[model samples]
Target chain A: MAMAAFRREGRRLLLSPVSYNSSFAARSAILSYSELGPMGARSISTQAVRNRMKSVKNIQKITKAMKMVAASKLRSVQVRTENSRGFWQPFTALLGDNPSVDVKKNVIVTITSDKGLCGGINSTSVRVSKALYKLTSGPEKETKYVVLGEKGKVQLARDSKNSIEMNITELQKNPLNYTQVSVLADDILKNVEYDALRIIYNKYQSVVSFLPTVSTILSPETVEKESEAGGKLGILDSYEIEGGDTKAEVLQNLAEFQFSCVLFNASLENACSEMGARMSAMDSSSRNAGEMLDRLTLTYNRTRQASITTELIEIISGASALTGFSQSARATDNIQYRRYACMIKLQS
Target chain B: MASTAAAVPFWRAAGMTYISYSNICASLVRGCLKEPHRSEAVAREKVHFTVSKWADGKPEKPSVRSDSPEE
Candidate 1:
């Protein structure tokens, strides 16, 4: 209980410092990056100058720390993303070429993370989804959305007239299985009258930028030339479908398998993008907080010095007055002692 | 809204083995006559599934151990 009270008091003191305004004033004092950079020609006040230096130093420390953390996370996520890359190339390539079934029964599977604050990763994907929706908005074209994240569901739901067929929010908790994806794939293939399917997701470019990409998940006929072209590029050995099954039946099964593969890949990319966005947002916030602390410390120091100077002046004046009063009393006491000695001599 | 094909049994359609109904397996085999990819992938997967189950009810690796002392 005592510890809690102590923490509360500490928080209050930190919250209501005398120099809080100075910190806010410091940030507002500078507007542009050029003004903040080495090339700007504004001569600042000594106090403001000191505060700015301190604030920038504080900001540098925070951004540096955040950059390190992001770098580490990017390394791990990059590995996972890279490992899953080859797994889907054949699937995606095969699905691109085969045009066996009608696409009117197709569904677009969109993968997005549940959380936000990862830059514009989610927004970019949402925008792409909206674009795709607009393209497929004809009266007879049956298009339904299957969203993986609640954030994407909410965003796409606003613009899309078609009902969301499924929303899978437990992506992080549950490792997506072929069984689950097959159920969705089957429903999409057999139940809906989709002509083709597409997926919109953030393809992680770097720690800072994620490109929102719209990939075709169905209508395999579009991929024939691309696959053939990719085959000519000298890496076609793994692209071979190894089975004795008849071409039509083999292609159909391969289509479902490929769609599931792409769906899983999109989910992973969404996770990486979400984490990266969160890391960057948190970094900027910590930097802003650090700058505030610097300006407040400067103000607190100035106020303390002024109060000390006032006390010093009062002390000096009181000392001088005491000296004058004591000197006069000493002179009077000397005169009285002399007078008393003279009177005693006269009386004797 | 999507259609729920409740009249058609689960195992008859293109579904993973574990969740499929018995009737669907027969349908799948018949369906394989026309759709070879579905048949082949299912056949390959089912072989793996059967081999993983041992005579003593213990689960075993699907790979054949050529270096076993008994062999």
Candidate 2:
């Protein structure tokens, strides 16, 4: 009967999720104990349990610290992202969006962060860039990528290695600004020959959510051609030229300036999204660690109590056998003791 | 609608390219911002990176470059 009771107890301990962390020796000991009865399983090592708990606690601390850091960074980047919308929105309104117009040569600027542990922000940008490539590329249409930051480059280089024209890294070491972005834009314009520039980035929608967005800016030549072909030049024709500059020159200036503005705003938005994603990812990791710690602690306490009870029973049974006490009385005593232990467990 | 005036921007009259013209405009806007935000924005603009051009599915050597708003 005692052997049956110990076997049942052993089975319950082994079934717990906490047992997954148990070392091979400890698990083998439990298995042998269940088969050989209480005498064998008596030494379920709480030492291994304690070690696992310590490691888990250290991990939780690191994740908690990362969460706090990400939160603080998110605040500053969010402010910059909000303020930068005003810098780019006016230019976007003036130049207008021509989504349906097809351009033969395209430069896709994929924007992402350098460091990771931020969720899917980089992957989303790469995914959207690949989708854009599929939509734009054909025998006649050519699409090239100007990948910014390290994370996107790593992912894009896996499949679309041929399409990548330029790779820029370490852009996130400092905070982003319009002047820096304009220089990058100028370099891109000087290097790549494209009729349209498509920027792919994660747009920060909220603390927990972000959307992959693509904003396209037509080249001045493409704009002029589209306007002439469409024959709806109300907005562009309205602005009068000054300083003896031709309409084409003004359009060229506007296109270049607009690229810098949009690029600046997109980089800021991606930074904000990266921070927010990291904050949430770290938060969930810490929470999961906490939950695991709670379960392991409970199992540890239970194992300690079970081993103590087994020792006590061994002593009592030995004494009763020597002192000529009835087996039935000792069995009853053991049942009562088990009930008391269960009460203590419930209280704890 | 009010009559739109035809006036030349100073940068354009000086024959500056749009990149330099816009950089000056951005710095001016940054200067106009209040207190801590102005300083913060200015600091954020300081960037350094290594750019590498890729050809035939391989990356060439990288060149280190730093860019500041003042330049």
Q: DockQ of each candidate's interface versus the true one?
A: 0.03, 0.35
Q: CA lDDT of each candidate?
A: 0.52, 0.79
Chain A vs. true chain A, TM-score per model, equals: 0.58, 0.83
**Per-chain TM-score, chain A, candidate 2:** 0.83
Q: What is candidate 2's lDDT per residue for B1-71, written digit by digit as tens?
A: 01122555566566555887667777888899999899977785675776899999888897766965654
All candidates' TM-scores? 0.52, 0.80
- Model 2 interface CAPRI class: acceptable
Residues A111-149, model 1: lDDT tens digits = 777766556777777777766665675666566776766
Task: Quantify how close model 1 is to the true structure by its C-alpha RMSD in Å.
Answer: 20.7
Clashing pairs in 2: none
Error of 1 at A184 (Å): 5.9
